[model samples]
Target: MGDFSALGEKLKATRNKMGLSLSDMSAKTGVSKTMLSQIERSESMPTIATVWKIANGLKIKLETLLDDSSQLYEVKSIDDKLAIKDDDGRMIIHSIFPFSPISGYEVFYGVFKPGCNYSDDNHTNSTTEQLFVTDGELEMIVGQNTYRITAGCSLSFDSSEKHRYINNGDIDANVLIIVNYE
Candidate 1:
């Protein structure tokens, strides 16, 4: 059986390691103590919004919450490492490459499900955004232009432009999106 309980335990441990209490998180994230406790106990799976709140409260990325696997660079089975979400809500599954120098780039992978589009937030820094479509098709809106990206196609554009991704495909669209946080 998949150990979702262990996943909850790991999340709890990460929060405790940061010396944060449930009350502290509640105050910081506005998430109720009871809800957080249930999440920690594996009684409930947190939604994307709830996960965002917890990650922000812990001052970490959303990927950190799902990284219950072994050390970075330790190869594991694809099913063991991939964090999949079926909900149409905004879910960001990330894999931050291990032990890389802090440069201007932050690399990760994302899958925007059909008709799903995240907030059109511009970059916080002067940066470049690149995307390589791996499966299906997606419509990427960069400022005014909407480009149809198909499998094996790639795009690079200014990160400062207000951008959003939509899965124009009938199925989920997978893409590797890299943000150059220069």
Candidate 2:
């Protein structure tokens, strides 16, 4: 929920480059046209899922819209103030490192309340995700497979196919997810 006017401009440019209008983007991303317009107009800040949807629908990297810094020696830390949240705050995402095309990878720290998760279309077909649970339990569902990852445990898998991370436990789940794009 930070200042994302720059992001709105970038989004407008990307959409124009793709020959897409708000309605077209809405069709592709499953986001509402009004919301998409609001995003394009800098009247709204998208949630993590919205970011993923737009990136996936446009077949672009997450950082294509999120990267705002280019310092050679940037001092960055994972802070909650930078988190993007769902309306209910069930899922919170803090981007530790925004992936650059040069780096081909990104990192995120996330907190998931019970029943919270990413949408099935959260990633592209040419990436791998490695997730480490630091606090509570999570169920990583991938292509009909459900893997339970506990605190201090990790899970790595291809992200192209159907996948999502859910916290079905009673407590909140803290996780670090590293995504490597091909």
Candidate 3:
């Protein structure tokens, strides 16, 4: 099966394992029931933001929903990595490391165009994020605090609170982000 179909099956199985109905899943994910149903049926492809919401609602790492973890070793080039684009296509996230329940962490390489802002809701409990700015500038807001990180800078914060990444520089902002679920 294709990746999307596999993802749909996984979603359905996860929801079933959680004993959550479509309505219950919708309530938790903030995605409409119809949309969730469509996703589970592989009738619709969810956006990157939608995928994140589902992962958070399910209390699982995003990689758990993206990668087939049964493999012992996997090698992926930039072109082979799973990538998701924002609604406006201003932000792209490349899945650099797959999710492993044993490892309890996932990594992503993100690129944000100038003037792009990607806001995210709180993740599951005890989740934390580490971000390293590789190029340009990034304005990261966690809860009520904002930090400006330039190239070669890194920051870590609790991700169980609302957060936002804003690219205010004229150039694109590139970052390596790692999410840990403790």
Candidate 4:
């Protein structure tokens, strides 16, 4: 689970840094003042949609709103990476690159068990994903098209459309995914 209190603190700090009061934030984000207050007080957890709106209103990247401040440079090994698992536990994604507005990109190392399928909704407009397969096979479906990506192969596609990744091979599928935001 995410640390809602930390998120709330970041929101409040960002708003304060911008010299925006609750009313100002509400006006800019089109979110109810009460809701914003609740979120800032850690009494409520904002939905992804609400967060997106807030990020847009603040004119910052979504990652900027969520990322923790770090040193000028950092290194992360496999064990240091944070992994997110799917609800069904058949897919796992390790964040290989920490989110940063300056980089304008996010990277993940994903593992899909045989027969597992991961479906994703459209991302922000003009976002693109480059996927490189390292092991096994992956079936990628983007919009109305489908492509079979084998080991050592790479595929790039606009991620602003619905997509799915299926591991139909007998073994686990390993893929490196890089997402670039426009």
Report the lDDT tens digits of candidate 3 across residue range 134-180: 99999999999999999999999989889998998999999999998
How well does candidate 4 score on lDDT at residue 95? 86
Per-model TM-score, in order, reads 0.51, 0.56, 0.59, 0.60
Any idea what lDDT model 3 has? 0.85
Please give, for residues 1-182, the per-residue lDDT of candidate 2 as tens digits.
Answer: 45565788888878886678788889988889998889889998999889889888876887777767453376665653488897378889888887644456888898989978765556753588899999999998899889999999999988887887788899999999998886
Poorest 10 consecutive residues by lDDT, candidate 1? 95-104
Q: What residue runs in model 4 are displaced by over 4 Å at the alpha carbon?
A: 1-75
Query: Candidate 4 has what TM-score?
Result: 0.60
lDDT tens per residue, model 4, 37-110: 89888899988899999898877777666765553466668887678999387799998885544456789999
Clashing pairs in 2: none
- How many Å off is the CA of 126 in candidate 3? 5.4
lDDT of each: 0.72, 0.82, 0.85, 0.84
* Per-residue alpha-carbon lDDT of candidate 1 for residues 1-182, written as tens digits (9 for 90 to 100): 23344657766877676667889878877789999889889999877788788778766666666765654566554455456453356445565442121234666667777777664565777578788989888888888988999989999989888887877568767888777753
For all candidates, the clash counts are 0, 0, 0, 0
Would you list the rank order by TM-score, best first? 4, 3, 2, 1
